[model samples]
Target: MIQRFKASLAITLAIILSFTAVFAGPKDTYASTVAVEAKSAILVDAETGKVLFEKEADLTLPPASMTKMMTEYLVLEAIDEGKISWDTTTQISQYAFDISANPEYSGVGLKLNKDYTVRELYEAMAVNSDNATTIALAELLAGTEGEFVKMMNEKAKEMGLPDYEFVNSSGLNNSHLDGNHPEGTEPDATNLLSARSAALLAYHLINDYPESLEFSGQTTAEIDGQKVTNWNWMIPNMPGSLSQFGYEGVDGLKTGYTDLAGNCFTGTAERSGQRFIAVVMKADSRPSRFRQTAKLFDYGFQQFQRKELFEEGYQIDGESELPVTKGKEDVVELETNDSLSTLVKKGDEENYTIKYNISKDKLDANGKLVAPVEKGQKVGTAELVYSGEDQYDNILSKKTNTVDLVTTSSVEKANWFMLMIGGIGEFFSDIFSGAVDMVKSWF
Candidate 1:
């Protein structure tokens, strides 16, 4: 009877453990990873720069034609800085002309010694992934493709890309440059960027020059009477093969391919007022990149949402007011200056706390705000501190999970008589406290 009783207890414990594992929720299956078919991949919220998912995101690999993203950024910057305009024209060099004339490379035919406007070349490079046109724009802006490569590296550093190397304006292997690779780069060198770096670059591009999408989103465009088609088949409403892989809200990004890089795509999509950027590098096939991107979008859209964790003017517990210095009021009511919203896993909204980050510049030596404070004046920021097991940093160099902290009402400086009275009270209070300490010591 004793042996039978012990066996029964063991069976009961095993059954309970099995049930617990079965009902732990679907999130348990993918809390730390998602199914992505690629060498390196990442998904990020466009507005917040918060990473939603990543897999081998820091592994450096060839970027292929995606290198033109930097070239495109530089051209747009030049145009915005008043150094060039869409109408500005430059004749192609021998190198550009030769590359354009080659059937092996992607290009629209360029006539030697003929002028091409910035608009024409930009459209060709953006929509068609034209290698020669990319070089032409680089030369036009930097006087040489080699110098433009320098600018690309500098800008990448400024943007805080975690890992990247830009050897040429176009992403072609140096051997493909027909023995005319950029002046400073080696013949074997090629452009390289990690999945995280590519996503970050795309984030900056989409946010900085949204106008570029006007071309990248195009299914097809005519340049000098030659038809050019966008290689990205994910664009909705695309012609012919669009029905096979068209994804809604996908528009305006870049694609890359080479023997070494395999297939890569930096894709962005929006739905129900939310936008996400996804990058897939070294995918096995041309279609695999788009399919992998679709999986990332499905995970993001189905499992997460932009939740308003804190409403506007919501006051934090124990931090509802701030001490005032030399003001009519001893304390000033405080609240969030604006709503704090961010992308979070659905149903996990209660797992965050507010961390007050009061700015020193707004305070006096006494760790209190000075008098004459205006209503709604920003004092510092309130950061949202997550208390969950799954936490990911934003792709940006700075954190985005914070909102401004502001004063609820204005406070005026106290009158001279009131100041004098307070000073007298504090001086006496200090003396009394010291006397009490002295008495205790003597005892």
Candidate 2:
């Protein structure tokens, strides 16, 4: 009989092990995959701002036309704040006409002294990387391009662009560094951005103004009776373009290039309800930036998952029950007040830990929950924290995500008779436990 009992115990242990294996979190290395051939790059989950991958992310480099993203953001913000109207016309200056308004330069064909609406100029600058169009908006918004660059810098400070610097709204720094501008507003001398900072700006812009995608994603637009195609080659197939470097779910962002900056792109792609932002800077070629960004997107979509870590009205621990004193029932169910959510990368879930902390104030002197409990009463909290580090050893978020714990249902006070019965049951349970201890001590 003893041997049979031992055999049964072994089977029970094996079953428990299987159950643990089934429910245990997966073990994974929280790290980026192969590197892209960009001088600096970073890929981040837009919703969570979690960096999935990065290379030289904080190294400052020229942002080229990407600076216009900030310009667009400011203009849009002004329009939203009622400071500027879409129909408001801005006049082109000799500077705007001299810099870009011809076949040699990419622009929406703004002639010197010609008036263009704010909406049309936005299209020209955002879609075609029109330097003149961006400068026109700058002059309108801040009286001069130099002053607009100053506003851009101040906005950058407010937005937490750690290593981002603006020299001009158009990002035409290389050519305009020596051009005439206000003494204090020359962004041309300081137009530099780290991959991480630039990606952050992209995140802010996309989240704040998702409508900007409608303009940036356009493959072609007409300006001054002439059709102009966006310089970005990742906008899928157009009528005349034979490029197949397009990616699905890639909506809008911005691309940049210059002799000193090489090729760069701040790309945002959404797949399966998950959006990822990738910034590739100083790539060897224009197509290389798009290809590198696509690589990051592919990895992001495949390697990470958006998971509801904790659910409302569910016990954080698989089995959690609290004994209630002088209540209609002997026990009550506990649940989380809110669901804690996160984008967990594959192979790194096991490292994510959830800790439950029950409130001591909720219990009586005997360590049992008292009667007359109300549902949804805040009893405690559960902290969900991720322990993954980026390549730079930077903890993605130093703060822990938490959810509140609460009672699932009310516990009315039990009648005197029922309370006496519960007390007797508890007394018997303690007696039985003591007896078992005595038996074990005999062994």
Candidate 3:
């Protein structure tokens, strides 16, 4: 998988360039992990999806308001796809009005027959955790909230979420409300999302629809003449907020709480060019959720440093590069038009391996890439893994990143005579390569 990533690149190429390029050792569980009180928790590298730390990540649990992240995601997706404009007006259906008034749930007080723009409802749903507004948005987009939940579930499947079941667009279970359920809706409905899935959903939201942070991260907003505060306490100035906690980098994400699920927060922060997502589900208290998240971010930011493994559009500096067959040139300069980066500990790049994900069968026995290599054409990618004793490393010690290596100059099919000459050269080169490895082993 040629997953495009951005990190720091400080490791120098040590051997001949190949289809396989590795950075450091394979990473597993990171060390010195901070214990979180949540029932399920995961801290991941936002760019690389590396699970730096996790506890019962796949154990499914009620997501509560964190489920609203999905609700707002579909809304933003519609706005981006031009299906609905921010100004697109939607009516507050009788069902939405019932949920707001009868249950007296959190909302901007959406009333029956009142028309609110998509932007207003979205802000209410995301920032204020307004249940009525989210249901309204869901019904407007999918004809009914139930249908919209189906879409949400489908999206979760598409995103490879380990497990997710969205009960309502509002993330409200029947138990949370004291009043009657809307006529057609099931009172027992509730969303279930594991920490891994929550972090994954947050990843899609922050990366795909960055504009969402504008709403989720805000300390407060106003809709329909009502002042609303973003429930995410990580944001500064929120009610009884933990913004005083050291991490000002905590920008945007979601928070949730319910009778079934304790206080849960899926948090993200960027410091020193590194962005990390930490999800703590079912914590005993709201403040502790942020506190645990803060500890996770501290572990990530302090222990990990961003490294650029391969720079995008950066030319390979080596003059004696590898040969390419069936091309006009006997050899071609290789460089990456796309960059890749990873997060590694401060000083662990000393002996990393280049794990080439390339299909070596495409190369001649001499290990030369076959011809028709076009400029900017991706022949293969180089992944940074580990070598020597470092192969058994984990997240804190190794950072895995991959970058596409393309031809700096295009290579066309050579004449038949040249092909024979290249084949012979490859044969000898392979032997020499093996011999060189044998000699190096002796040393």
Model 2 lowest lDDT segment of ten: 1-10
- Model 2 scores what on Cα lDDT? 0.77
State each model's CA lDDT, in order: 0.86, 0.77, 0.72
Ranked by lDDT, top first: 1, 2, 3
Cα deviation at 288, candidate 1, in Å, is: 0.6
Tens-place lDDT per residue, model 1, 70-93, is 899989999999999999999999
Error of 2 at 190 (Å): 3.4
Off by over 4 Å in 1: 1-33
lDDT tens readout by residue for model 3, 1-443: 00111001101211211112233223223323466666667888887777777766656677888998888888889888999999999798777887777544785667777778998888888787888888888889998776887788788877777667665777778555444333344576456777888998998899899898888877888987889877677775555534564357877788888786779999998876678999998888977888888888888888777776655665545532568757787787766656656666557766554544545765799889778776776666766664433223122224456677666777788888988987899899999999999999998
TM-score of 3: 0.75
Q: How many residue pairs clash in each candidate?
A: 0, 3, 23
Query: For model 2, how does the per-residue alpha-carbon lDDT over 1-443 read when each residue is reduced to its tens digit?
Result: 01223323433654564465445432112222745888777888887687777766766777888998899999999999999999999788887887764554465667776778998999988888888888889999999887897899888888877676676787765455346554564333536777888888888898899889899888888888878887777777644543577788887788887777789999888877899888999898987889898988988898789888667766756646778878887787877777888777777767776777888988888777888888877777887766665331222334456788778889999888987887899899999999999999999
Worst 10 residues of 1 by lDDT: 1-10
TM-score of each: 0.90, 0.76, 0.75
Give the worst 10-residue stretch by lDDT in candidate 3. 1-10
